[model samples]
Structures are given as structure tokens and as C-alpha cells.
Target: MALLYQFFTALWELTGAMAPYILFGLFFAGILHEWLPENFIRKHLGGDTIFSVLKSTLFGIPLPVCSCGVIPLAASLKKEGASRGSVLSFLISTPITGIDSILATFGMFGWIFTIYRVVTSIVIAFIAGIVSNIVGERGDKDPAGSSASPIRPASFRADPPAPGQAGGACGCDGGCGAEAERGFSFFEAMRYGFVTLMGDIAKPLFWGLLIGAAITVAIPENIGEWLSGYTWLGYLLVIAIAVPMYVCATASLPIAASLVLSGVSLGAAFVFLSAGPATNTVTIGVVRKMLGSRSLIVYLATIVGGSLLFGLGLDLFFDTMQIDPRSVVHMEEHGGWATLLASVILWGLMLRFLLPPLFRRKRRCEGEEDSCCTKG
Candidate 1:
């Protein structure tokens, strides 16, 4: 009973610390969704040049898409004639951090960690993109090196079919967000942020919170102090799980912070934050299909290698500069009324979206598909 109480207490505190920033971030995410020109990404990311790769990395920074969500968007870019490097860049960059994620990261981990995350993601993304371009020029190119080679798959070069056309495996996620056309309204933007975006994330957020609280309650305190000498092992462990997992950027924070509180080095936590949101099995298959085998290798190698390198660099900087990671960790256990209110509101919103589908599933499970119990 005491253990249960401690678990719930930890969960609520984590929620209180993150709820307000998440709401603020979601509002801005909606604003970005509506205001950013629909064609802006497509227009600037077409060329086979360094600038195009650079632009894609910058553009992906503010997007709120997760690793899975970004796959189709990246495929659409590929279909729209964006260079391979640019597509890979967008894939790598969009998922690891975003506006919603940035705010939550700062609220929980402080500005230093937040800034470092953003910076390192951008650098890793840019480098991955540049390397892809180089590999494309050498290995995936025409004899003249002026364009893509004939050996490239036909599906890779084909444009997606027009509306209602669904024949090919290529550009599969291209229509992932093809909502019916509607006039722009501020209210609608807020609806997307609060309702649509929140709904998409609610399940993962719930699990992250539950798992984080459980870790906090279960792990022995200061275990990290003993594990400090094996930071490399920690990094490897984080990567092993994170790279194949499907947690979204915002959903990953509480788990990372809890790991920190439970004696995991900050660098390992950073690894989970960086690698988890950006790579997963589905995205891996999509990369191979849309980009090719060579590009897939570049994509995976860059993210895994780069995340490890940056993770180590972060640890070195902290030790060399005598920075105490715990001091910067901002897990607010006792917040004001605003925080409590936001936590309640956030939970309510999550439940509103999460429970209905679950209830329907339960009802269906209780009876046959044609039975009354399965009826809506």
C-alpha cells in the first residue's frame, strides 16, 4: 500500500512539473501547423546540394512529428523530388526534438540540457544529411554523377498517384495527413494542438508517466553513483533499447528524467532522449524502401554513431566543467495551483481520448462482432 502511494505520488509530481509547458508547447505546435506555408518545405528542399541538406535539417527542427509520423512525410519528400540527403535529413531531425518537445525538455531538464539536445540533434542531422549526399554522389549516382543512377529502383523515382490513387507500396505515408480542405481558424489551430496532437500522444504519454513513476519508486537511490564509471555501458544499453523503440519525443522525457533521478548518468538519459524518438523498426523499413540500401546504412550509422559520440561529449563536458547534473534537473514535486490545474487538465484530456477507444475494444471483446455489444 505504501509502495502504491509512493508510485502515484511520483507520477503526479512528474505530471505537475510537465503539464503547463506541454500545454503551452501544444498551442505553439498548432500555430506552427497552421501558419507555416504548406509548400515551404517542398519548395526549398528539391536540389542535390549542400544547402538543400542544410535547409531540410533546419526545417525539421520545429516539426512535431515522431519517428513513425516523419517516415511518410520523408517519403513524400522523396516522391516530390527532394534529394536523398534532404529526405534523410528531415527523417533524422524531425523526430528527436520539436517545439512541443523543446518546451517539455526545458521544463523538466533545465535550459542547459534543452539547449544541448537541440544543438546536438541539429548537428547530427546535418552531418547525416551531408554524408548521405556524399554517398549518393559516389555510390548511388549516374556514371556522369549528374543525377541518380538507372540502377536505382523504379519505385524510388516515381511520383505518387493523384488523389484516390492507392496502387503502390511507394509513398505509402504520403497521404497520412491529407485532411479535407477547410478555412483556417485560430480555434481550429488550437483544436489540432489540443485535440488532434494530444490524442496522438496521450497513450504514449500515459505509459511514459506510469513507467517513470514506477522506476522512481522501484530503483535504489544513488545507483548512478556506483554506475558512473561504466557510462559507456549505460550509453550502449540506452541505445540498444531506444533505437528500436517507438516512443515519441514528448513521451520520452519523464522516463529519461526518472532514470536520472534513479542514479543513471545524465549522458545515458540524453542517449535515450536523442535516439529513441528518431529511430524505430517501421522507420527503418521505410528508409530502405524510399531511399535505398546504401542510404539506409548511412541513416542508421549516422544516428547510432553520432548519438553515442554526442552522449559521451556531454558527459565529458559535465565532468570537465564540474557541472552537477542533478542541480539542473527540474523535477518539481511541489508546484503552485497553476501546475496542479494543468496536471488535472492534461490528465482529463488524455483520458478523454484514450478511454473511449479502449472502452469500445473492451465491449467488442465481450461479445461477437455481429452482436449488440459490438454495436456503436
Candidate 2:
């Protein structure tokens, strides 16, 4: 009974620690989505080996997409004629992390581990793109050859707005909307950014918190400890399990931290950190269909190969450097009150990010109903 109470308490505290930042990250992600046009991405990014890979990584890094979400984006890119190489690079990088995931990684793994995670994600993305371009056979014959028109013509301009079809108040449309026709203002843009962000990220933040709590409660400490002894096996287990399981980078960090404290090998935790986002069934299927079987193989190779190599390096670093694993674990004993206070503040901030948008949506629906009733 005492164990059960302790588990629930730990779970609640963990959720409080992580939910706020993820909510903020989601808003930033929405702003990026609204601002970044697909045409711009296609024009500069597609082509020969090196440039394509670089652009793919750059474009993919900050996007809020998770392992499941990467599938549709990669597929859409392929449909829009993004080179197989660029698509592969984006696939490798997209699931890795963003601002929210990075912050969560820091909260869980500390600074050094987070750095390694981000750097490795970039390297894997670039290498995957380049290698696919080099080794994979180009599948389709280009009917137009060099004369084929690029997806976006250089002279083409975006469609002009209709009169009175004012721009969305959310400055995300770059003053191209009806509001710009009336008057452009910076404060409106900022307002839009904040509101749009609240709408988009609230669901994921809620889900992440719930999942974090469940893992904290359900998993036993000894399970993690037992696996630590077989570090390599632990990595393999994480890979095998995580490959089929879908988890975003930010949400996975707290669970990894808990597992680590429970005695799971750090190497295994790193594997979960890397592979959880990179290779999943949805991402794999999309790669196979859009990029072809060969590109799919290359994508898997990149993530699996990179993760294994990094995991081994981490294991060696911990073993040879004699780093104390216990130092990473912050239990209730040391600075417990401080940790609790911080956790509460974080949860409050997350609540602010999540609740307002829901209220707005409800109000909007109510207004629409009132208008319909009046018309009737």
C-alpha cells in the first residue's frame, strides 16, 4: 500500500515537472507550421546530394512533429517531388527533438547527454540523406529530364487575397491577409502567435503528462536495475520495443529518467532517447511507399546504426570515466521541498497554455449557435 502511494506521488510530481514546457513548445511549433510554406521548402531543398541533405536537416530540426507525424510530412514531401535523398534526411531528423524535447531532455538527462542527443540527430540525418543519394538506385525515369519544370516556377507569385477576405489576425500569414489590407500591426501578430500556439499544443501536453504519470506508477524499480547489468541487451530491448511503439521525444524523457533512476543502464536510456523518435511503424511504412524499398532500408540503417554506436560510446564513457550513476537521480530526500515547489509552478504554467484555447473554442461554438437561432 505504501509502495502504491509512493508510486502515485512520484508520478504526479513528474507530470508537473514536464507539462508546462511541452505546452509552450507546441505553440512555437504551430507558429512555425503556419509561417513555413511548402513551396519554399520544396524550391530550395530538392536536388543533388549534399545541398538536399543539409536543407532537409535544417528544415526538420525545429518542427514539432513526432515519430507518428513524420510519416505524413515525409510522404507529402515525396509527393511534392522532394528528392528521395532529402526526404530520407528529413525522416531521420524530424522525430529527434525540438525546443520542447530538448528542454525535457535537459530536465531528465542533464546538459551533456542532451548535447550528445541533438548533435547525433543532426549527423544521422545528414549521413542518411547523403548515403541514400549515393547508394540507392534512382527508381523512376524523368520524362522531362533537365527540362522538367521545378515544382515552383521562379516567376510565380502566390495568389492575391479577395477583397474583405481579411487576413487572419494571427500575423502568421505575413500581413498577406485581409488585416494587412486594412492595417498591419505587430501586436496582433504576437497575439495570434500566442493563441495559435495554445490551440495546437494543448492535446499533446495533456497526453504526455498522463503517459508520464502512468509509467511512473506502473513500472517497478527492480526491472530497471536488473536490466542495467546487461547493458547491450538493454539497448537491444529498447530498440526492439521502441521501434514498434510510437513516442515523441519530449514525452519519452521523463520515463527514461525514471528508468535510469530505477537502475536501467544509461546506455539503454540513450537508445530509447534516440530510437524512440527515429524509427516507428508509421514512419517506416511512409518511407517504404513514398521513397521506395531501398530508401526505407537506408533510413532504418541510419537510425539503428547511429543509435547503437552512440549507445556503445555512452556505455564506454560511463564505465571508463567512472561517472556515478546515482548522481543523476534526484529523489525526494535531497531538496524535496524545492523540487516540489518548482514542479507546481511548472504545472500551473502548463495549465495556462492549455486551458485558454479550450475556452475560446467553446465560446466560438456558442456564438455560432446563437447566430443560427436568431436567423431561424
Instruction: Note the Cα lDDT for every prediction shown.
Output: 0.77, 0.63
How close is every model to the real structure, measured as TM-score? 0.84, 0.73
Put down candidate 2 lDDT per residue, 184-257, tens digits, no spaces.
Answer: 33443334334433333345445655665566667786875667566678888888977776767776776676
lDDT of 1 by residue, 71-187 (tens): 656755776678888988899899889898999999998888899999999988898888888885575542222222112121111223355765222223454323334465797
User: Model 1 off-target regions past 4 Å?
Assistant: 137-183, 357-376
User: Ten-residue segment with the worst summed lDDT in candidate 2?
Assistant: 367-376
Model 2 stretches astray by more than 4 angstroms: 27-38, 139-225, 329-376
Task: Say what the RMSD of model 1 is.
Answer: 7.3
Point to the candidate with the largest TM-score.
Answer: 1
